[model samples]
Target: MTEQEYFTVHHQLTINAEPLPEGSSLPSYPIFESEIPAPFIVASEFSHLDMLNDSARKELNNSDFKHVINLLDTQNSKLNLLLTFLLSQQDDPTYRTITSAFGASQCTFLSPTSLNDGQYVRIKLFLEHPAAAIYCYASVVECQAQEQGFDITVKYQLLRDADQDLLIKAALNQQQKLLRQRSLDRENNQ
Candidate 1:
């Protein structure tokens, strides 16, 4: 038999060296054995993944992140958005103006007076350029109402890919910049 085949059939046994006491009220135990299963051995040969560093693998597991920027509405020649999040900070509303293959356009407004958690809002977005006037609608997915304004997440129903790309890029860019500034401020304070 091959070494691997012999190893597969071999069961390592361990036994207690000490003898039981005379007249002890105990049954004698012989041995303990273990056989490594084929599947387990094969699994052990695979490399473990570091999830933190695996952005592509992580993205695959997060399909919801891909759909987070769905389209909300479309009208006239313009487009509107139903973003996945409401503007969270006073300085960071989750909308943007972009220049794309479609030309200069803007995601111009969100609705609902307040952004408290569980409070829903219908957003109105406008696309102004190339001939003027476009509209879209969105429903709030998540939100927090504060003293100044509402932080919200809006989901778009029918916005186009190009427009959605613009919104996502804009939002992510703003968030990254904000995070960087905060980190800088912390370092400066320290």
Candidate 2:
């Protein structure tokens, strides 16, 4: 299949490889999706978000209401952490940020560790904005050694429909955030 079949975006990933045969053909395994939602928002956090929104709405009659709402929105925005992540080094110890390219069908990224082509591995992804985490198994399609590390391409296997949807949604959200950043940067530069 063509690479363009699904949209791609740059992101950071936490990866773990399951051992396989010394040398093998394309490996296959089931994907393990994280039960936790992204942006680390849990059921308990909904009240916090709702409270912020409620506070902002109650002040609609104030003279500076618009600006006040904007301020609250900035702090409570779902994408706030993601924007910060996109601009700075994230503190998560699980996975390091690499120049990652991901789509619905496959993902390619760079890493310090070398994984053989056809090797199966567990991948953990923290997607931007609503910051959902997805865990899945993939087979290495290609692994080229670079001066710095390994540039690896992988095709996903045994992913559930929901997990596939999550990947696609994350890619779309990330692309939107990247575009937003680019536009804002352009505006400031102008």
Candidate 3:
């Protein structure tokens, strides 16, 4: 998709953005299943429901199965809460940063320090509403200075298809909520 077509939303999500160790290189292509990192394996397991929900949507679009989809989504949120509890022990506070905007392809966050262009970083993102976690690698695409801090945008690299799908779903869901809120506000003002 063109960059403009790639949907992004202004949402605050906690992310751990740690620069990869010196000399580290990120793969240009998706990581092989066998070579996937342990953290990402756990993340993929938690994100399994996103795939199930997507499949149900495709199969039952506008059908009575909307209830089924809603039920599945509710279950997914509960599972994510459990996942959050399980992973909380492993979470490191030092690397945490809040994303200013994010989508399937890229994430932008404010950082006290600027990252070099083309730098590689390992990211662990936490979705608050859905309570899901994502682990991936990213390449620094841009770092622009803001009044308070630098705004760093990182392009996702070597992301598993499932994780990317989850991100896309999250972005669309957030957009829907924003639109609904705006509509409600307009109605109330009239």
lDDT of 1 by residue, 1-190 (tens): 0111100111111111121233333222221102222222221221111113245545654676543323211221122121111111111133322211111122212223443333222222222111112122333355556564443444443333433433333344445666798899999999
Between prediction 1 and prediction 2, the one with superior TM-score is: 2
Candidate 1 at 145: error in angstroms? 7.0
| Clash pairs (backbone) in predicted model 3 | none
Off by over 4 Å in 3: 1-5, 21-23, 27-43, 50-78
lDDT of 2 by residue, 1-190 (tens): 2233676677765443343455644333321334323333331243335446675577674655787777766776755555435423323444454546887788887867787777875555555434444455678888988898888888876455555666776677778888999999999999
Model 3 accuracy (lDDT, Cα): 0.76
After aligning candidate 2 to the native by TM-score, how far in Å is the CA of 105 from where it should be? 1.7
lDDT of the candidates, in the order given:
0.29, 0.59, 0.76
Ten contiguous residues with the weakest lDDT in model 1? 1-10
| Cα error of candidate 2 at position 57, Å | 13
Over 46-131, each residue of candidate 3 has an lDDT whose tens digit, in order, gives: 66755666776778766767787777769877777777776565466888789999999999998888888889988877765454
Of 1 and 3, the candidate ranking higher by TM-score: 3
